[model samples]
Target: MIEKALQVFPKSYVYRNEELILEPRNNVYFRLVDVETEIDFKCKMFAWVSRPIAKSLNKYWAPRVLKSFNTLMDTNFTKSDMYLIYDRLGNDVNRKLTIRFIESGYDMELLKR
Candidate 1:
């Protein structure tokens, strides 16, 4: 799964970084990529990664690190709930829904341009 997600981008750019810059792109699909095909492979990779991570509940879990999300309500939640919340936000595995959901607790409608 990890290997698949990494494959979405160029292999030369893979590495551990001490710092990162995260941009909040509300509409991650059409807005970020000029063509929808770019995300088709990514969506599959996301789905693959989400499955196993969704099952793990140990402290410092993979989902927490990968998603880096904080809920609006400060309540204990499971990884399954996280996946469900994201699924409710967007029907697919694009990270846009998760980003928007993390930004606004309410379900945000994705605009099609």
Candidate 2:
């Protein structure tokens, strides 16, 4: 169970008193955290897509998703701070949505699963 948990989670245990610490220190755990977070974000997107809702879906999801992400990553992101920009140069753009993390500044990839 520890192997399975450590496989998906960045830190197996975090200790605190004098200072905060994460276990399994040799794994370069931050990258593991990032991978888990990206997968989670994609899963949420998939779940939201599969949900049977006829209402304005984007309207319902933006705040809810952003709030969850903020709490997970310890970031102060407001709905107003989020931006969706279209940079495709082709006129045949049929709504291709891609998240380029650091360049785009949309750090949903840092969210904890």
Note the Cα lDDT for every prediction shown.
0.36, 0.32
The clash count of every prediction, one per candidate, is 0, 0
lDDT of 2 by residue, 1-113 (tens): 22343333345442332111212332211222323454443333222321211122366554544454344434555643332211121111322222333234545443222
Residue 1 local lDDT, model 2: 21
Pairs with backbone N, CA or C atoms under 3 Å apart (clashes), candidate 1? none
- Lowest summed lDDT window (length 10), candidate 2: 83-92
Query: For every candidate structure, what is the RMSD over all alpha carbons to the true structure, in angstroms?
Result: 11.6, 14.0
The per-residue C-alpha lDDT of model 1 at residue 91 equals 41
What would the per-residue lDDT of candidate 1 be over residues 1-113, giving only the tens digit for each residue?
22333333222122233111121121111122221453443343233333433443344444443453222133344565546643543345456654454445334333211
Candidate 2 — number of clashing residue pairs?
0
Q: Model 1 Cα displacement at 14 (Å)? A: 11
The regions of model 2 sitting more than 4 angstroms off are 1-57, 84-113
